[model samples]
Target: MSRVSILALALGLAASSLALTASAATPSANTPSAAITAAIADVNRPQADRDRDGDRKPAEMLAFAGVKPGDKVVDFMPGAGYFTRLFAKAVGPKGRVYTLLPGELATRSQKAVDGQKALAQDKAYGNIVPLVQPVNAPVFPEKVDVVWTSQNYHDLHDAFLGPADVAAVNKAIFDALKPGGVYIVLDHAGDKGSGLRDTETLHRIDPETVKKEVEAAGFVLDGEDDALRNSADNHSLKVFDPSLRGHTDQFVFKFRKPK
Candidate 1:
């Protein structure tokens, strides 16, 4: 072939390669499973008299937790049945989602009491089982693949519960999971080195403190994801102080029980 003809052929090949690369880089329209997508849509839909946005992150967090259609899951303190519904759908009909609401909350908070009552009757959440036991109680019928808690860890440090009670709660969760099971936690971020101070005022907790505490319970820190990181947060303000509210900086950690 002539030199000019050879150059033109090379250019054509390069153009084709570029086109293929572009196509490969573009995200596909393939969505999450129909069941999961539908459940997420239902949770995001606006409801009458509901003030807080669902802020559902199960789709993202479940990915981090490596939750599968057949994995058993436990949603600790599944307030208003938000994550409970998501877990129920993600685990599908074959898997189970135990919605473990602290028995203390059920007895003290009328809203929690009503929510649990409503969840018990929801047909859509047939895979969900409500376990109204104290946080320290091992009421799970079977070992779970994933034990997940979101925005509720800070409450464990409340004055109403002492250190022993909090430690017992963590241990109970540790015992309920199978060896190699995952424990995924997502909570508001507090100031670095603030210890548990944020738990009291801002309803947040230091990520370092959480790691040390869970490690003490025989959980290994598998990994952490920066998907929820927000650099703008100063971490001094309360999560509910209007300035932070829905956009507060958050941390996500994945711990595992050793097999």
Candidate 2:
């Protein structure tokens, strides 16, 4: 080959290699999922919800969860419908987002229950389905694509949630998912070795404890993302503590039911 032709081919190959590398890394993180981005930008989202976006990093977390259009998602213990609304939008018209309000929240306060019902009735994100799950015997209507709990998994071990049978909760989640479906547990991080010790007081639990418990229910650890990690958080303060409120160190785990 002529020297000029060889040089041109070498440059072309190098450019192609770089493009391929970038494409490979895109799906790994921070890449915009059209559905997620649209959901976040939806006009129906409350201003208060939007204000927390910077700290909560919903886009990154949603992307990590791998939510997509037409997915069936369970937003377990969906507090105030924050993620319920997001999931409904992200899943689009054909998908369904089930707001699994535990029995405590369902019966303890009528206002809370009414709020979820209200959200479900909204036309903007009419795909949301609201249901109350008994703490001890959680029930989901059908196998879904993803089951997710955010910042509240620790509550399952605390008194507020009947100190729910964590095992049963896990198993229900395992059963609620289709084979190969994902379960996402996102929560505040506790000190490395402290298992459930901090669940009630500090409102945190070690990341490993979550892995062990979920795995015990027959889920295989699939992937984890550090998108929400705040290294400066020492795992000592309550999640509501003013100094650490919005920026508390958090962990996001993805476990899959075996296919």
Best by lDDT: 2
User: Per-residue CA lDDT of candidate 2, range 65-165, in tens?
Assistant: 88999999999877778888888999999999998888886778888788888888998888888888787787877889999999999999998787889
TM-score of each: 0.81, 0.91
Predicted structure 1: lDDT = 0.78
Model 2: per-residue Cα lDDT at residue 188: 97
Each candidate's number of clashing pairs is: 0, 0
- TM value for model 1: 0.81
- Per-prediction CA RMSD (Å): 4.3, 2.7
lDDT of 1 at 193: 92
lDDT of 2: 0.90
The alpha-carbon deviation from the true structure for residue 155 of candidate 1, after best TM-score superposition, in angstroms, is 0.9
TM-score of 2: 0.91
